[model samples]
Target: MMTDGLDGVVAASTILSDVDGAAGRLVIRGRSLDELAGRTSVEEATALLFDGFFDDRPSGGEWRAHLGQARHAVFAEVAALDERLIRHGPLEAVRALVARLADGEDLATALRLVAAPAVFLPSYLRLRAGHAPVAPDASLGHAADVMRMLRGQPASSVEAAALETYLVTVCDHGLNASTFAARVVASTQAGLTSAVLAGLGALKGPLHGGAPGPVLTMLNDIGEAGDARAWLEAALARGERLMGFGHRIYRVRDPRADALKRALATLGVEAGRLAQAEQVEAAALAVLKDHKPGRRLETNVEFYTAVLLDALGFPADSLTCVFAMGRSVGWLAHAREQATSGRLIRPQSRYVGPAS
Candidate 1:
């Protein structure tokens, strides 16, 4: 039997990460989400994901240096940026720049693909805002440097820690749509850049990485905590799906949502906004329960992702690009794994049309 959208299909085996939807748990390597997220730097998490994937895999410290160097290397491509690319959104602009990288399966190539978003995004954002782009500081950690480049100033300890938590939380989670896309391309022995580009293409879909921005839009529409229930009820009555309340896999609350909420708490978001968000979350949960009593609908990552990234001063439009910065490492790791150990991914499709 053919499964639509390949639901319940086992596409490839991986040692990378697992998403236990029933348990609301995410495990990367051997570590749980809580164990790795706020406790590890982006470099350390990247090292964990990269372990055993490459013959020349760098240690955590070495990965930090290589990631910094990769960022500097990717920064060189910023000179090629122009109004044409910047006219598109940040994700597209970054994807265009990443397309310029030479395709390869080597560790250096993987590192550059991983670093591309962190380098290209701030450059694209700054250029779009009519400011000069900031150069990468190879001495700083990956998450800290990304924040510094985006703001053209150093991020505080709390701000950098928040970003690191966000990055690590999203770094990898089983064979997600984007990770699967990356793996499919890699199974073709397409280089890491091509695999990552495939992942970016998949992630650009609204059903995937694009939901966080709309969550912000929903929050803005609700305006105040007191207004959340009525506005959400009306929207649901009109057949509008709430942006952040449900997940495809997770029957319980998403663990990443809590991870991001904890990260948001550290940023000292304004009292009114946080209170409004908390109230809206409670309201959304209640409304979802009343509207769809049989279905289990709960807060997912996008809800707090919108709140946290907004608190960090990132533009709503660039949130997906920020997501890419973390997930790129996972994509590269998945790509390397597929290229090294897996066969080509060629699935047969049943014909539904009339016979020729």
Candidate 2:
């Protein structure tokens, strides 16, 4: 028998992070996702993932300094991509520019690969929007600097914290589609940049990193609390798959969804709209329950991800690009881990055709 999508298959062992779908828990480096959300900076969480994993891993203040230096190092590469910016969205443009970086599984190469998006994504977005790119602040933390570059102004405490929470929450998960792609490329002795390119390619697909923007679109379509039930019912009647309602894993509520919802609540913007989102969520949940009683279709991260990022003033198109900024660290860590395995990730396929 074959597992069609490799569901429930254990392909590799990683010390990076674990996804306990049955329990609705995510743990990174043995720390629970809830504990790290608002309490830790993205740099700190990156360091946690890197500790004891990389040979030349820098920790504490030094890690932040190293990442800062890496951001500055990629500045020229980001600028060079300006002419080609019109050809791709921010995510694709950043992927192409990052592929041009030096290749290797070494510590310096990994740091630069991880920093590429943090440095390049905002530049790509700003340039595409007909604005001059803002330079990265070598002194500020990763999340704050991303916001700074995007808006060309310093982020307030709340804005910085919200982005940091998002970055930290999404940093890594167990053998996700993109992470698996990165590992496969790394297993072939490819450089970190090549592996990361593979990961980004996978993430570009709708099944993985594509749903967040649509949740906002769905909310915009609903418009009012009173219309939410009827709107959802009409959509369901037409056999439309509701966005942000279900997950492949997570029998219970998605912990990441809950985490992001709390982050949006903390930011305290668009009170009326937030209430509308709540109403829509409840209506959608009820509809899903009545329509499909056997399946547990609860809200996933994309719901409030839409709310929080929209509230932060990001255009819907750039949402996935921002996701790449956070997930880059996880990809690098997984790439480095796969490099140490020394075995190519080759799985045999069963032949079904008749023998000649």
Candidate 3:
């Protein structure tokens, strides 16, 4: 009679995390996600996520150096891939690049595999747009190299720092749906590369991290601040969700949204878009609070994820690619951890269909 299984079973014994969706709490490697977002570097966060689990964690500078090396190593491999079928799309190209990393069996090789998409997708965008994608450099920081490969120039110090902050902040949360999927694959004793591919496929879904781009489209459809509330109401009546409004977790405002909003401002975002997002946020918050006074629904990470990526000179389409850069760290840690546990993650399913 285990119809709906009870929640929060002790799935594993790890010092990694606990996400209290009800209390709006997300603790990572011992600190709250709010406490870590934008306050730490990707390398720092990776070290934290892998702490106690791995004996050797690189410093921020060292990790950057290693990823740069990975970038070059992967680029040579991508050259050998079927260029005709490269697909010229972020998810497809990135998936191919991620899958290619399995050729190397070591952890460092595995990291490079995971890091390739962060470097490759941007390059693919440029190539698709008829611009030559620049290669990565080992001397720069992680964010700076990623920007350089995509844009043919290095990111400004402020922009680079902001991007790095984002990568670190999102590197890992608890067992979110995507991370959980990765663990499930890894639990099969599938290699880490196989596990990461599972994560990317899961994240490609709109319900997961893929909604940020459409949030921008939603804002565009409203056209102006004056159109927001009316458009939102109509959309709601039609059973449409205002992108970036509700969250699966977090009853209050998502702590990640504000941190990214701060970064957007620091990066000198366009005023018009920022103003529109602000209006939509204000109108949505007021309406939601009044409509469901006791409910926990609030602005989630997608809200500012839309605004921030938009401000970075990326078209609305680049949201998932950028998100992949940040999320890959979390995927890598979870995949490796699950593989180390040496247990399959099979859950019993309820049989409600026509019983025989």
- TM-scores, each model vs. reference: 0.98, 0.96, 0.91
lDDT of each: 0.90, 0.85, 0.73
The digit string of per-residue lDDT tens for model 1 on 5-52 reads: 898899988898999999999989889998987999988888888888
Candidate 3 local lDDT, residue 53: 44
RMSD of each: 1.2, 1.6, 2.4
Give the winner by lDDT: 2 or 3: 2
Ranking according to TM-score, highest score first: 1, 2, 3
lDDT of 3 by residue, 1-356 (tens): 34353354656665577767677677887898778877776656766666544555566557667766777777765563346635556787778767766642255756675567767777777777777767778777677777777778777888777777677666776777778887888788777677778888888889987899888888888875457778877777787777898876666677777877878778664667777788888887876676668876688888888887777766676677778778777777777777776489877877769978
| TM-score of model 2 (CA atoms) | 0.96
Between prediction 1 and prediction 3, which has the larger lDDT?
A: 1
The parts of candidate 1 lying over 4 Å away from their true place are 224-226
Which of the predicted structures, 1 or 2, would earn the higher TM-score when compared with the native?
1
lDDT of 3: 0.73
Clashing pairs in 2: none
Ranking by lDDT: 1, 2, 3
How good is model 1 by TM-score?
0.98
